[model samples]
Target: MKSEYILKTEEDTKNMAKEIAFDIKNKIIFLNGEIGAGKTTFTKYLVEAFGLKDEVCSPTFALENRYETENGLIIHFDLYRLKSEEELDMIGFYDTLKENATILIEWADKFNIEKYIKKYNIISFKIEDNNIRAVTIK
Candidate 1:
């Protein structure tokens, strides 16, 4: 099953994120969308909802970032620059999935790690014509 929402502005998107936060915890979330699709922005709101004390930024160049909260931990990953699946293997991505932390990945549509990614949530971000964004979750 899935749900879709039209977020007309950044604020609308954040509100949607808040709604999603209620259903998630220590789960893997794959963010799929093109560049400038607000993947990172939604990520920030989600992280904040979890009570992260610091700022949240895209792990674009850093590849990945880990944040701690009083309740648990969250790990954000950017796989846009990865040249090959071997690169992911080098980063111990598989092992990371076993850890006790919530995982959110930007540019996740690039990988075919279906076996490992199964049984997780998938968020698809789509840019609309009127400067709005369409977000779908399954």
Candidate 2:
């Protein structure tokens, strides 16, 4: 099953994240969207809802960022720079899934979906306008 939502601004995005926070537990969330789509912004809201006080930024350069939260740990991964599945293995990608943590991965299309089958909840975002975005959850 899938659900869709339209967000008109940053606040709308945060509100949506708040709603999702109630149901998200130690699960992996795959975020798929184009550049400038608001994936990072949505993640920031989710992390904040989880009680993170520090700034939340994209892990594009660092590859991953780990945030400690009351619920557990939230691992944010940016796979934009990763070139191959071998590289992902070298970095212990598979092992991360075994940990008791919530994962939010950006640019998830870069990885093979087979590896995450039945292990993740996938969400896709599309920019509808300068201030509006359509989010789909599956």
Candidate 3:
């Protein structure tokens, strides 16, 4: 199943994130979007919806950020800096999947991650006009 949302303001993005968070069940979510398309913003809201008070930031430099919440463990990964699939192993990507956690990966489409991950939720963000974002979840 697929769902689409139009995020015109920060409130819309926050509401969408809260709604989506309820559906995450030890799943991997692949976030697809260009820079400034609201991926990180939505992630911040999603983490908040999970009752986590920790600050959420893009892990572009560190590669991965782990959050331990009352709901469960949430791992956010940014694969933009990764040059090869081997680096995923170095980052313990596969090992992390074995844990009972919700995984959100940014720039996941950069690699052939679908081959390894059979089950996942793909949330794609497209810039429509005047900073409006069209987000689709599948």
Candidate 4:
């Protein structure tokens, strides 16, 4: 399944994330976008939708961050700084997949992990000029 949304403001992104958070069954989501894209912003709203009050920050340096919510754990990962596949193993990336938690990965396109994951969703964000963003989910 795939859908697209034109986000004109931060509120639009928040609503979209909230909708996806409630509707999507797939816990593993791959966030594809470049720097300055709304990946982190969307993530913040998604976490909020999950009933989490903890602040959400990019795990660019920390590799990953985990937030426990009423539903379950929401693990957000950023592969932007990962140097190699071996680093993934070192960071216990594969191990996390085995757990019963919602997983969101940024820079997932850095490596081909689709074969390893049985079920997942891909959400791509594209910046259209200064105030508009095109978000597509599959």
TM-score on alpha carbons, each prediction? 0.93, 0.93, 0.95, 0.94
Worst 10 residues of 3 by lDDT: 17-26
The residue ranges of model 4 lying beyond 4 angstroms of the native Cα positions read none
**Once model 2 is optimally superposed onto the true structure by TM-score, how far is the C-alpha of residue 7 displaced, in angstroms?**
0.7
Candidate 1 residues lying further than 4 Å off, grouped into runs, are none
Off by over 4 Å in 2: none
Error of 4 at 1 (Å): 8.3
On residues 20-66, what C-alpha lDDT tens digit does candidate 1 reach at each position? 87576798999999999998999888888888758889998989989
Best by lDDT: 3
Q: In model 3, how large is the Cα lDDT of residue 138?
A: 89
Candidate 3, residues 1-138: lDDT per residue as tens digits?
Answer: 339999999999999988878797579999999998988898888889998977999999999998887788888999989999899999898888777899999999988988887799999999997889999998
Writing each residue's lDDT as its tens digit, candidate 4 over 20-86 gives: 8866533899999998789999988888988887789999999899888886788999999987778
Q: For model 3, name the residue pairs that clash.
A: none
lDDT of 1 at 29: 90
lDDT (Cα) of model 2:
0.84
Clashes of each: 0, 0, 0, 0
Q: Candidates 1 and 2: which is better by TM-score?
A: 1
Tens-place lDDT per residue, model 2, 26-117, is 88888999988888998899888898867999999998899998867989889999998888888887788778888888887877855555
Please report how far candidate 2 places residue 43 from its true position, in Å: 0.9
